[model samples]
Target: MAADDGVVLDEGAVVLEDAPPSNLDKLENSPPSNLDKFLKRFRALNPHFVRDDAEKLVCFFGDSDISHWKELPRVRITGDEGASWARCVNVGVGGAEMLHVAFYSAECRAKYRPDVVVLCAGENDLGAGAAPPTVFSYLEKSIAAFGHLDDATEQAQLRLRHDPQRTRDNANVVSSLPIDDTKSQQQDGMNASEFSRLRNNNTDEKVPIVYLCTKPEPVADAELRREYERYDGRIKELFQRYNSSCQEELLYFIDNSDLRDPSLYAQDGLHLSRQGYQVWDARVRDAVERVLLKMDERVLAP
Candidate 1:
């Protein structure tokens, strides 16, 4: 349970703003035309079925934090030197972990044919009591699953976008193991170090680039906070390894733990507030620009 300040709503309901009628009931009762427009916009923001004709397609895959990107106003993607660039597509699903993200990655590659994919996961696996090796394996597998596919199969999947009846499977694999709320705090920092060493030695590159976001520290009960801090530390360490690894500049990590200000969090202390989403949008835009610049530079160098 979150603190009183956290955003709390009934199951199957989403709070778009800090006001009345935050439930889906209002949407359900709206006129057909209004509902059609709303659904169209929602589908546009979350393009799981069809692919837009954007020159540069970027897909964001993760949990609630990634899903919240839809709440932010669109921002121009200016490169590192302020030259405008590409737009992004959000394929986030709340409560998703690496397993779910991996599945979605395949779908995004086949349908959207994204030029870049941002993966934000692992924290939930850590919170769910997954061992460090297990977590690392999941991350590696997810990245690998996004690797190049056969041309014919890829084209077939891409053509499916034209089929109006084509639908996406939303099922996810859930772990039944009880969460170890305090287990992270009990371990020495050695696990993070080992994970970092293993990750750096792999020198793996699965896609053009995989933008990873470090887990933010949770602002909840004392026990949960401690565990989150430990998990966050591991993420930072893993990011450092990613930077030092000899792989191509195909994996970039962004640290967003600083955005943990109380005012930026909803009552649940898990999701972001509207203001928080704005801040996140700015950071993500900057990172995307940097990546685009690097890609351009690499292309022009030869």
Candidate 2:
């Protein structure tokens, strides 16, 4: 959660803002987007995803769990001798709710029609009191929002135009607050060529989307854990129906039953410690490898 302090620290991120220390004075609301500050920091840290080689990228979107799994990409790429197999980018933002997932990955989603997109959200959404149906609605919105490659472009535009819950605390920050203005604001202008090319090449491409079921963590109470279970059940039930009908598999549901044990989590009770991360890393790697292998077989077939 954001606070009066100038430093916004998540389990894996520390975002600094140049604001007055005194909340006794007039308060300054954060930018309208839940992901504004985090995105700024990410862009500064990893500009190459947008600028340089992002071939065979597997982009992950979630909260701190994904963000905190900072080594997943590098460790694999190192083993593969510097991404000969694939590269990765983690666009997870700590404290991000379910609704924020798609928007957080929109740029990469648009730019690199990644070989795979893995989503690891929903626990935070449920913990925040959203019903299972509501959390699922956010997932549905994300799935629909990126049905086509062009939809990613539209999502970026829509983000600029509309931010939900804007009427209450929406105050324009000073121009000096560059973090408030998205990198999208600076980069959307150069995107005409990129998008135009994407529009032509991928008019009908259906990218694979993987939804990693919500994990039971220590932060949520018993009722919240139950809600997490309900959300996961809803996800499994709905995707099973979708998978059964579709000839070509586009949606995948990965279960997290192995992660139910409390010992897997760190002492903080939110993030996964090394032991828990071992489980998470395996889940992510297995999903990515399966997607890549499927792609390889298709390309090599007569």
Q: How many angstroms is residue 184 displaced in model 2 relative to the true structure, after the best TM-score fit?
A: 39
lDDT of 2 by residue, 10-121 (tens): 5323222322222202212443344566556545545564634445777787777777886774323332344455677777767776655544455556755676788787
Task: Give the distance in Å from residue 236's predicted Cα in candidate 2 to where it truly belongs.
Answer: 1.6
Backbone clashes, each candidate: 6, 0
Structure candidate 2, residue pairs in collision: none
Model 1 bad stretches (over 4 Å): 1-54, 72-85, 148-219, 222-239
Local lDDT at 210 for model 2: 77
Task: Name the best candidate (by lDDT).
Answer: 2
- Relative to the true structure, candidate 1 reaches a TM of 0.58
